[model samples]
Structure formats: structure tokens, C-alpha cells
Target: MPGIDECLLEVMRLPGARGAAVVDWTSGLALGTIGESPNGDHEATAAETAEVARMAAEQPVFAGDAAVAGPGTRTPGAVPPHPPGLPGLAVEDVIITTAPGYHILRFVETSFDSSVFLHLWLDRAEGNLALARMRLGDIAERLVLA
Candidate 1:
């Protein structure tokens, strides 16, 4: 597995990648950051993005509504689709596209409370949404939270 810094570097190598960070959605903190931030401030961007991640992860309605995990889609929160017994939440990732860029938030599943996610900012014209999402998923898997 790669460390947080290395993982973020790999993310920046992606097409259209403008900035990347390992953000703790629970506390709205950026554990690591690289490249240019959306607002010229990595910390603020991390906090702002964490709001979206927290909202998506903590809400059960999004999970239940996730018929398909397409762009701008939010995964289910800490519950099983069936049996519905576990208090744990779930998420693959979340993508928010804009006129200027695309935001990809890939959730990192930890052995404990999985509150961290990888945030990637990419240029709208140069970025490939599908590719970025898939690559982020790969990075998320290799990311070690400890």
C-alpha cells in the first residue's frame, strides 16, 4: 500500500487533475495536500468538501436512493441493503461536477470508523470523469489509514 503523500501524487498524475488531498471528513481536516486547491486554500477546500462527504455518508436516504452509483451519486450510510442490522455506513465515492472543474470524493474504508476520503479536483475540459472515478477507487483501496 502507498502512503498518503504517494497516493496523492498518483492522483495528481491523472488527466486534468488540478489538486488532491486526503481529507478527514469527520473533522474537516486535510491530512495531506498537493497541487492547486479549488479556493487557493487547501484547508478551506477540505472543510468545504468534507461537508459534502459527511452529508452523503451520514444520510441513509442517499444509500436507499442509490439505484445506480453514477456521477453526483451518494452511497448508502452505515447500513446493509438487507438484514439492515449493522450501524456502519458505506460509500464508493461521490462526484460533483462544475463548469470549471470536477470534484471526486473517494471514501477510504478503514478498519475502524472510515471517515477519510480522497478529494480530487480536475479541469473540466481536460478531466475524464469515468477514468478519474475508477482511478480514485483504486487509490482508495491501496490507501492505508493507519
Candidate 2:
């Protein structure tokens, strides 16, 4: 399996892919990053993305949803509540915005419970959103950190 650096490299290979970063959703820290603009700060972006994910996970609507519910009624796969200013959502992947560009955030389902994800920034003009999503999914599956 490829590591985070290799995964980001693959993402950069995608058409219209401008930059990519592997982030820790819990702490909003970047594990690795590539292709970012000189002035474009990825750390802040990762932090903000993490906050969004956190908020989405905590919302009552998302938490109450049956899809997020685990095997039994007692067990829920919902995101835990966070402190103020944090997102309350459980983000699986693919957050796109027309204003800036396509922001793909894919959560890493690892055995260690690291709560990490891939944050990809792509140019809408040259990027195929659907293909990018699919590729990211594939990359996520292949990632294995040493």
C-alpha cells in the first residue's frame, strides 16, 4: 500500500489538480502536502476543513440519521460533539465549492483510528469532479502508512 505522500502525488497527477494535503481531522494538522501556491497556506485550510467535518458530525440531523447508526441501537457511528466553533459533521469525502474550486476531503478509515483525510484542491475548469472523486476513493483504499 502507498503512503500519504504517494497518495498525494497520485492526486496531483489527476487533471486540473492544483494541490493536495493529507490532514488529521481531529487536530486539523497536515501530515503531508504538495503543489500548494506560494501564498496558499495549507495548514489553515486543513484546520478549517477539519472544523467543518467536526461540525457536520455533531449536528442532530446527521447524528440521528439511520445511515450513520452502527449495527445495534446502542452503537452509533456518529461523530462526537465538539467544543464551540467546531463543525458537527461526519465527513466521508468530496466537498466542492464553485467560489474557490473543488475541495475534496476524504476520511481515512484506518485500523488505528487516526481520523485523517486527504484534502485536494482542484481547478474546476480543468478538473472532472466525478472522476476526481472516484480516483480519490481508489487512492484512499490503497493508502497504508509505515
Candidate 3:
């Protein structure tokens, strides 16, 4: 698996990639960052993105039937709650499209708390939304935090 720096380098290789960061959603901290931030401050960007991630992960709507039925309740055909150590929901990524750019928040599943996610900023004109999403998923899986 690649470490934080190497993984970020790989992410920046994507076309139209303006900035990238590995963030800890629980604390709104950037573990690593590269390229240029949307707001000219990577830390602030990380904190803002983390808020989005945290909200999405914690919402019961994203948790499916399991969340509505209560933690341990199960219906005959309902999807199960997320596995322990995973997010409360099974959200893989969140995408935000603007007039000029795209923001992608790809959640990272770790052996521990699973609170980290990879954030990518891509120029809408030059970025391939489909390709970036797929590549980000691969990068998130191989990212290793120290």
C-alpha cells in the first residue's frame, strides 16, 4: 500500500486535478495535501469538506432500513447496517458539481475508526468525473496513514 504522500501524488496525476487531500472527518484535519486548494487555504478546505463528510456519514437516511428500524433490528429483505469500523452509512463517495469545478469526497475504510476520506478538486472543463471517481476509489483503498 502507498503512504499518504505517494497516494496524493497519484491522485494529482488525474487530468484537471486542481487539489487533493486526505482528511480526518471526525476532527476536520487534513492528513496530507497537494496541488492548489479551492479557497487558497488547504486547511480551511479540509475542515469544510470534513463537515460535509461527517454529516453524510452520520445521517440516518444514508443508513438505509437498518437505521430506521433501530440498530439491531432486521427486516426480511432490508440491507444490514454498516459493519463495525465502517461509517454508520455505506456512502462510498460524495460529488459536488459547480460551474467551474467538481469536488469529490471519497470515504476511506480503515482498520481503526474509519473517519478519513480523500478529497479531490477537479476542473469541470478538463476533469473526467467518471474517471476521477473511479481512480479516487482505488487510491483511497491503498492509502496508508502513519
**Full-model lDDT for every candidate:** 0.84, 0.73, 0.88
**Residue by residue across 1-146, what tens digits does model 1's lDDT show?**
89899999999999999999999998999999999998999999999999999998877656533544444454434333521322355556789989999999988876786789999999999999999999998898789876
After TM-score superposition, the amount by which residue 141's alpha carbon in candidate 1 deviates from its true location, in angstroms, is 0.2
Q: Sum up the clashes in candidate 1.
A: 3
Poorest 10 consecutive residues by lDDT, candidate 3: 80-89
Best by lDDT: 3
Say which prediction, candidate 1 or candidate 2, comes out ahead on TM-score.
1
TM-score of each candidate?
Answer: 0.84, 0.77, 0.86
Instruction: Name the runs in model 1 displaced over 4 angstroms.
Output: 64-88
Spell out the clash pairs found in candidate 1: 63-76, 78-88, 78-89
- C-alpha lDDT (0 to 100) for residue 53 of candidate 1: 96
Tens digit of per-residue lDDT, candidate 3, span 6-39: 9999999999999999999999999999999999
Candidate 2 residues 1-146, lDDT tens each? 89988898999999999998888877888889999732488888888877876665445555433443443543355444433322333445748586657888876666565577787888989998989998997898788865
- Tell me, by TM-score, which candidate is best: 3
lDDT for model 1 comes to 0.84
Model 2 misplacement above 4 A: 37-39, 67-91
